[model samples]
Target: MEIGEDYRDAVLPQSRWEKRKFVRCDFTEADLRGLVTQGCTFEECDFTRTDLGESKHDSTAFRSCVFDRTVLAEITWTGCSLLGSSFVDCRLRKIKVRETDFTLVSLGRADLRQCELSGLRFREANLVEANLSGARLRDTDLRAARLLGTDLSETDLRGAKLDADALVQAKFTGARVDLDTAIAFAAAHGLIISS
Candidate 1:
């Protein structure tokens, strides 16, 4: 389906975007805060440099979207599916994502402090230089994902697996882990501790 640019001009008000499909549209630098969209579909759209901060979405699906340099701070997402999305240089602080599927997403240089992500699938994601301080990552898969220069202080990796080269710059202050696992994991990363 071909999407028109004029549709972007119309007001997409909050609390009224359920099961609507907006494909191949340019939403760059758009102010979409506080917009509550449930079960909506966004395909092949460009949300680069967009301000989607503090938005609430439920069961929304975004496929093959380009969100490069987007500001997605303080967004609350639930049961959403974001497959094949690329988020380079994106900032995602204080985000609440629950029951979401982020398959094959590229989240390089993303700031993810105090974020809560539960039952999420981050398969094949590139999280380079991503800061995840005080973040909750339950049931998150980081297989084959790159995590160079990533800061993860106080992050909960209880049921999460560390991907290849995914802990280069991960910090673990105020974090909890099993002693054997902690010592083994940290030691493998050349982490030095004082007596």
Candidate 2:
């Protein structure tokens, strides 16, 4: 069912939003925990500071959405599309984002610790100052992605594809990688890894 086409601060929680559509809606500070949605669409929506933890979403599409400081911990989002979305200072720990498209998304200062983001595409996305410590990014593509001041300490980067320029510009202090990846990164910086 479609509701709140252009409303602000609407409280919609613990409801099933199957095949629903929301346009220019604002759910700021709303408690949406344990919400279930499937094939839902949100355009230019604002979910700033919303409590969306433990929510389950499948095939949901969001275009130009803002989730600034939203609590999305333990959320399950599968087959979702978040194009041009911004998630500033949001809590994203333990969130499952499988088969999702986050093209051009901005995750400025988001908490993504311990999240498993394997094989995900982060082309041109911004993750500045975000906490990715202990996160598993195996085979994740970070081409042209901005990771300046990103906290990748102790994070696993096995098979993660990074752009030469972006990787050099990012901060990976104390981050962990396999020997092959380490050698590759060293070679990119004109350093020879001699045995």
Candidate 3:
């Protein structure tokens, strides 16, 4: 267990950590590229300006963590839980996620364009103004997620589980959706769909 430790500007690349717990740790400006962690828990940790590119995590929990200006490109997460985490201005290009839970997480104004986010859970997440253009969200769960001003342009929302309120709140210009979703959107906007 590492609590309240300051690892700012530290270089720890390609490290393997398993079943470790980090609480309130500061990883500002650190280089942790290609790191692998499994079943690890990070609570209230700050990852400001940290480069975590190509990191692989499985079954890890990042509760209430802050990722400000963090480089998370090419990261792979499987069965991980990011509950209550907040991402601000982070670099998330080419990130891969599988069965990850993002419940209550905040991703306001984050750019996740063209990312493959299929089958992930975003229940009650705050995604206001987030850019999800061209992302693949097939079979994803987004129930109760805040979509105010969220860009779903050219994004695929087929088979996604979301409420009618979410459809009416998000921007869906040029988005691909199934017939059920389209009908729901129309109903949410008070449009009479006969046929």
Roughly what TM-score does model 3 have, to 2 decimal places? 0.96
How many clashing residue pairs appear in each of the predictions shown?
0, 0, 0
- Descending-TM-score candidate ranking: 3, 2, 1
Ranking by lDDT: 3, 2, 1
TM-score head-to-head 2 vs 3, winner: 3
lDDT at residue 62 of model 3 (Cα atoms): 96
Best by lDDT: 3
Show the colliding residue pairs in model 1: none
> For model 1, how does the per-residue alpha-carbon lDDT over 49-158 read when each residue is reduced to its tens digit?
77777888899998999987777888888999889898887778777888888888877777777788645888777777777777887557766666777777788777
- Candidate 3's C-alpha lDDT? 0.95
Query: In model 1, where is the ten-residue run with the lowest total lDDT?
Result: 6-15
User: Of 1 and 3, which scores higher on TM-score?
Assistant: 3
Task: Show the colliding residue pairs in model 3.
Answer: none
TM-score of each: 0.80, 0.88, 0.96
TM-score of 1: 0.80
lDDT of 2 by residue, 81-168 (tens): 8989998878787899888877789987888888988778888889888888888888787878888888887787888877766556
Worst 10 residues of 2 by lDDT: 1-10
